[model samples]
Target: MMRVSLSGARGLMLISTLLLSTTAFAAPDATKIANSVVASLQAKGGTKASFDSAAANGDDVVITNLKISNEGSEATVPSVVIASPVERTPGGFTAKSIAFDAGKVVDGDQTISWKTGISNDAIVPDPSEMHSTAKITPFSHFEIAGISVVNKSAPDPVTVDSVTFDLGNVIDGAPNDGKLAISGINVPGSVLKSAGQGASTLTDLGYDSLLLNIGVDGGYDSAKNALTINGITVDGKDIGKLAIGGTFGGLPREKLQNADQLKELAPTATLEVASIRYDDAGLTNRLLDMQAKQLGAKREDLVAMVPGFLPLAFSQVNITDEAFKTQVSDAVSAFLKDPKSLSIKFAPTAPVLLMDVSKAAMVNPNGVISLLGVGVSANN
Candidate 1:
């Protein structure tokens, strides 16, 4: 037998208290958390939902056979794995991450399927209190893989490698900056064949099928009341890249939550600058070749005809800006001949209110061109 001193006994009691205190802070009820997540999703989409079972698997909660439906459409998810470190918050719940097993959605004659989806730093707010704040986004990072879309009229499916979106710099219950990327979108040839007039033009330009990637990077600064589109780009493997960018001012934070506000605010926004650019990969020569063949002429002859034909085309649109017209004609001729890059830019001396531009468009349409300080250039 061992004898313990009073101080040793006291130390043992202290250790025991620490262990019990730790147990008191053990993870929140996993089943309850799963219920909250389902409720949150149902509230957001205005849909009905049910799950076959929800149970704790180690540190994660696995919810199986979750079905969400609205109207005639239904989405069936095989399982959802909500990762550990989930906590109950005043709003509802927050998780380290949530992952969805491969799922398929059926709506009318179309079916959409995906390999998997994962969201990081997911915040599932209380369904009953969702409208009390402007918190629009539920995750900081989200990604889906192996997406396929099938339509009844289309003979083949459209496939995508991956889609990702990221949000950060949160303020006022919304993100101040974000980015979206979609990679390896493959449109099958059979689908393009079934498409009507637009498909004909695409086929003529040497695209029987299409492989494309899209990206958008943008942000809004609430303090400045300014919205900036850094760049939006669509890139095709054997075709040209189309890029657009713009900046607008005087967008209030109140207008960020819903579509109705966006419609109401568009007329009053101020445009600082905007641009559209195209960088040819292989499509330019193909387009010229196709056009020349249609007219029964050589490609160079087709390019030569454009400069002289510009004034006639511009006259039909009431464009009397001779210098601007000449600039455009020269740019088009150069672009068609060498096929590198062409860009059109609009930058006024000062920010022009959209309302003012709309009025100018209605009253003096030709003057609107000068008001925007439009410029066109090629191969630079």
Candidate 2:
């Protein structure tokens, strides 16, 4: 028995036959790869089209408690426990978030722990190796929290503590290439004034609680075709301290040059906040002397007059967490007495995809603006 060493037992039987040939090579149906990543993020529209229509018609968007843990030969990365029920229909939006935790990806790293909004720890990759590699790169931290969205002429109820997306390297390749990113984001002026239809600026600023700070660098290079939004910074204390500069130019070339006359042109991308401040309250020189009497113009013409007179722009704004700062300061004093009705609307020929705005600036004497800086260009 002391001499039983046949070449170390044939190298431990070839490392147990390559760990049973990578576990018998069959592990690719994480609910059909999470429904083809929720249908390629609903055909790549903005704000990922409200999370792809709340994961397609809301209600248990798959992920029924899957748990797989292995460490010895390294093979973990499957720990999802989700319970969803989010309805945003005709005017009857509903909400529900119970025990949502995610994290467990050892070899390729992907961590998660849930409570509703969503906890974080991510390095993500191996969506089963991105289904045999057409082009799969991953790095993530897409967090969410106790989020809520309701309609039917809202009065009270809109909460989201977090919405983090630091998708560093999300490339999925070829002609229709890829890229999605995020950098240092913090949203919580009670989820940006409880979103849409104005929650009354937290009852006229008697101050209960309000805090929304945000930061995000940009990138979306489908192989240098271009879509780079590299600016947007906002601070808050009841709708003050803002900075939204510029940098958005021609970006629509994931190979769909015509796709039937660009699907009947309805393209749009606008952003303008040109200036705002209140900590010291210089009021940017009384809003640049009221834009120099509406003609001697300055502040980049009030941020390029936001698409010729405001409709949508101020790309990505944030002030998360606020209960009811005097109903968001009397709805930002009636949205600055009609600041062009502060708008937000998206409809690239809708298909379970739309984002309308105005919960009185999305909630708490609030002012939560988030525009993924819309893009789609190529009209040489």
Candidate 3:
């Protein structure tokens, strides 16, 4: 009888240990995760956020009737889904993905709506860190599809195919690199013609709709205290493409948190290198032809007039040096005649300090051009 009793007691201890292990690995609370996200949003600024309900659906949490407001603007989502969420810290969570369906934002007489949006590898940090110097971001990458804007004053809606932002990684609350891509921005010709002044140039250039795509990519190096811009490009189908790239130095990680600190560091900041390049698909020639027609002249005649006009334009900007002005005039004349590719480059003998450049500009603006090592080339 004693041996049987001891065996039963051992079996009970084994059963209790198994139960404890299961409880330790239990799923995260869905409702708590939803509330923490609302808390984080509110902590960010003059924003209010809430959700009607949150419940677990398999491994995902579905938040219903999510709404956010800032100032007089309000946005509402029918539902949001956070998939496979895991707690990273107390009141912080990371998820495999988050999704939004059919959201609308209302601001005065204008409304913006989207069919769907999704973010991958999302991070929701503690509320206390939202306004801190940490600069925490919520997601690594996100995309929204079928975005439409409607206004009471406008005749028709403007639509976008997609808008996306990507941050490769977050370390110490800063992105290692970043990108923003906006594609298929369609604005009607009537809207452009009515938008006053030079906007009509777009329509006159035979653009029924200004279908534009914009992209920006950049990265930072903490070790070198530098920021590198891969490129910021604007491409219009059948029009032209413009790209700008540059590198800047003397930006330490800590100074990024405060505008005042950055301002103080600006004097010592350096422009290491910079470039602007434009490739004309057809728009450059078309624009020159249109302008020539308006002035009752041929395209070649218009091109010839630019070299004479440039000095007058440069003089307005305090550019008095004849040699510098001549260089610019010749480059512009060549580009206008060929309508091919034009590139402007700056590569100083050494990284140029902002303070020296500023003082030189005030003393002699024309000298500042040479001080920056400006170079322009056409059809190269």
Candidate 4:
């Protein structure tokens, strides 16, 4: 028989109590946390949300067939599991997730959908009862292939091909430094010309291989209300490339959540063109063709006539051409064989406001985008 002493019994009871306490504090209530997040988003109104199955597994809440906002623009998520160990902070109980799932945005018609979307997000609400700000941490990536904008109403639907855009990386720096890097868009030259619907004067300018590639990178400092564009590169493949950089400030804190607030703030900014490299002959021939078509003449007759008016057309800035006629042909020949470059630069005198841009877009009379100069000739 087991014999027990009073001190031994007391020791046994203490061990049992410790075991129960450790189990209780081991993990958070994951299912309860997930329900709260989904409910909050839906409470914003005009939103309908539903999930196929939700169950607590280990420390994560697994959800399938999660659909939200299924009316105008619907989101369809196949599967997602979130595990947030609730941490009480100065702001209150904050639950954020590094967990996410791939999803698609289905158009209202149900005909087209955008696939290839990934997200890892955190929603921190105002725990102070004031609810003054949106403490949102967002991280997402979208890679779209062969995008097409179709106007079904038109008799002959306009179809553009080979469209692609992607955001490579993002960081939600909080309590630590964040990062933003590498996003770009690419389109063929043909699409730009045909976008007008009715084609006319320059339809014969054949540049099949020409492409527009622009890549952007920079950091946005929310604390200081500043967005610095570290690099913006525009590549024309065969024609040339241009690079620009600048900074923008004067962000309004009150306007962050309101779309109407966008109009009230005037951002102050400065921009400078770091470099412009273009194939001299390629540019000359491209213009000569346009002039020939407008004048109802041939390419040969227009080449010489075009150079005579080059300085006048570019009256906005000084242009230097040594042997204008011969150079244009030489440039065309050089670029046809291989890529070549001419230089350009632009530096504005004063800072420009974003609102004034719409009025000054055509002339830039304020010299906001001063054309420092450009040098393009066949001889070079």
Over 275-320, each residue of candidate 4 has an lDDT whose tens digit, in order, gives 4445443555666667678889987765545445645644454323
Candidate number of the best TM-score: 1
Point out the worst 10-residue segment of candidate 3 by lDDT.
128-137
RMSD of 3: 3.4
> Could you tell me which 10 consecutive residues in candidate 2 have the lowest summed lDDT?
86-95
> Where is model 2 more than 4 Å wrong at Cα?
1-79, 82-99, 102-114, 117-124, 127-141, 147-160, 166-210, 213-217, 222-227, 239-241, 248-380
Tens digit per residue, CA lDDT, model 3, 4-44: 58779899999988887677555568898898889878885
* Whole-model alpha-carbon lDDT for candidate 1: 0.85
For residues 1-380, write the lDDT of model 2, one tens digit per residue. 47758998999999999897766543323353344443433333331211112222223444443333334212221333323332221211112322244322223332233233342332223223323323322223445543443333334333445556555554443222222222223333454465543433442333344445565555555653444445455554444444343322233442234455444323332222122222322333345445556676665555444333221222234334233333334433444433322222222222211123233355421223233322211111
Query: What is the full ranking by lDDT, best candidate first?
Result: 3, 1, 4, 2
* Model 4, position 224: C-alpha lDDT score: 62
User: CA shift at 251, candidate 2, in angstroms?
Assistant: 16
lDDT of 1 by residue, 205-313 (tens): 7687899999999999888788899999999988989999998887876775556677877766899999999999999888789989999999898888878888888
Candidate 3, residue 266: the lDDT equals: 74
Tell me the TM-score of each prediction against the true structure. 0.92, 0.26, 0.90, 0.56
Q: Give every collision pair in model 3.
A: none
